[model samples]
Target chain A: SQTIHQWPATLVQPVGSPLSLECTVEGTSNPNLYWYRQAAGRGLQLLFYSVGIGQISSEVPQNLSASRPQDRQFILSSKKLLLSDSGFYLCAWSVPWQPQHFGDGTRLSIL
Target chain B: GIQVEQSPPDLILQEGANSTLRCNFSDSVNNLQWFHQNPWGQLINLFYIPSGTKQNGRLSATTVATERYSLLYISSSQTTDSGVYFCAPLVSGSRLTFGEGTQLTVNP
Candidate 1:
């Protein structure tokens, strides 16, 4: 069975600080990875997706960026975070024409 | 880009009741899936019905791809069923566009 792991289940960062969230998948190779954000009481918004290593696509312009450093490792980063950057971040992996599997997600709070 | 719409933004039901959630999409899609977001914020994939009907235990889903809509049916709802239900449609490539979701509250 495949599983996804996301780290720092919860995070608290001060404004303008750097941010880094990592996600990894096991039991699968060359899977499609995605980053999503969900504000309080809102639906998830796709932030970025990657098809392969070193290939990332930004769904929306914002303060965040994504990188696929390995076949199953994806990272979401920000040089300087904003208050609006606070939300629930999720990582997912999937194959073509298949349903996505999500991680536990990280609750990021910016002060 | 595709626009996905889910109806009945909010629903409240007593335990043992039945409910149906609807999702509509603009433009064609493949790999349409239904997910249940628990209060703990974990997304549980409920169904992967792209163009047909599938049933899993107390839950069932039907997707009419030609009509660009899908429906999820929950039978004998339980308190554990209380959560947000989302329908995501995969467009070109592997990007899944999600609907706003329907919040279901099953009172025990």
Candidate 2:
């Protein structure tokens, strides 16, 4: 079975602080990876998605960026965080045009 | 970009009740998935029904791909079933677009 793991389950950072969240998938290769953000009481918003290594697509440009350094490793980063960046971040992986499997998610608070 | 909409923005039910949630999409979708976002904010994939029907214990889902709509049926609802139900549609790629979600509150 395939599984996704995301860390720093919960993060608290001051505004302007750097942010780095990592997501790794095990038991699957060449899977499609995605990063989504759900603001408090809001629906999930697609941030970035990658089909292969070094390929990333941004849905809504903002303070964050994504990198798929390895086939099973994806990273979400930001040079500086903003208060508006606080939200629940989720990482997911799936096959071509298939249902997605999500990680537990990281609760980020930008104070 | 495709538009996805979920009906009954908010629903409250007593334990053991049955409920049906609906999702409608603006265009043809290659994939349709139902997810339950728990109170702790963990998204649990419920069903991956793009067409036809699928059931998992107390939950069942049906998607009419041609009609651009899907239905999720929850039987014998429990407190644990109280959460936000989201319907996501995948269009050209595997990247899914999610609906606003149906908030379900199952009271004891």
Candidate 3:
């Protein structure tokens, strides 16, 4: 069975601080990776997705960026975080013609 | 881009009650999926019924591609089933447009 892992489970960072969230998949290779965010009262929104290593697509324009360093490892990063960047960040992986599976997610709070 | 709409934005039910959730899409889609987001914020994919019916345990889902709609049925609901149900449809490529979601509260 395939599983996705995301960390840290919860994060508290100061405003204007750097941010880096990591997600990796096991039991699958070359799967598509995605990053999504859910505000306090809003639905999940797609932030970025990657088809392969070094390939990334931004769904919504924002301060966040994504990178695929390995076949199953995706990283979401920001040079300087904003107050609006606080939310629940999730990482998911899926194959072609298949349903996406998500990780536990990280609750990021900007102070 | 595709538009997704979920009906009955909020629903409340008692334990053991059966309930149905509906999802309507604005255009044709290549894939349709139902996900349950628990109160703790974990999202579990319930079904990937792009154009058919599938059931697992007390949960069943049916998607009509021709009609651009999907339905999720919960049988003998439990308090643990209290959460948000989201319907996402993939129009083209790998992006999935998500609906606002239906918040279901099952009381014991």
lDDT of each: 0.94, 0.94, 0.94
State in Å the error of residue B4, model 2: 1.1
For residue A72, model 2's alpha carbon misses the true position, in angstroms, by: 0.6
Stronger candidate by DockQ (2 vs 3): 2
TM-score chain B for all models.
0.98, 0.98, 0.97
* Candidate 1 chain B: 10-residue stretch with minimal lDDT: B89-98
Per-residue lDDT for B1-35 in model 3, tens only?
Answer: 67888988999999999999999999999998899
Best by TM-score: 1
Candidate 3 C-alpha lDDT tens digits along A14-75: 99999999999999989999999999874889999999999999988999999998999999
Judge candidate 3 at residue B32 and give its lDDT: 88
Model 3 TM-score? 0.98
> Which has the higher DockQ value, candidate number 1 or candidate number 3?
1
TM-scores of the candidates in the order shown: 0.98, 0.97, 0.98
Could you tell me which 10 consecutive residues in candidate 3 chain A have the lowest summed lDDT? A38-47
The residue-level lDDT of candidate 2 at A72 comes to 98
lDDT of 1 by residue, A2-110 (tens): 9999998999999999999999999998999999999998589999999999999998999999999899999999999999999999999998778899999999999
Using DockQ, rank the candidates from best to worst.
1, 2, 3
- Model 3: docking quality category: medium
**Top DockQ model:** 1
Residues B1-42, candidate 2, lDDT per residue (tens digit)? 788989999999999999999999999988888999999888
Candidate 1: pairs in clash: none
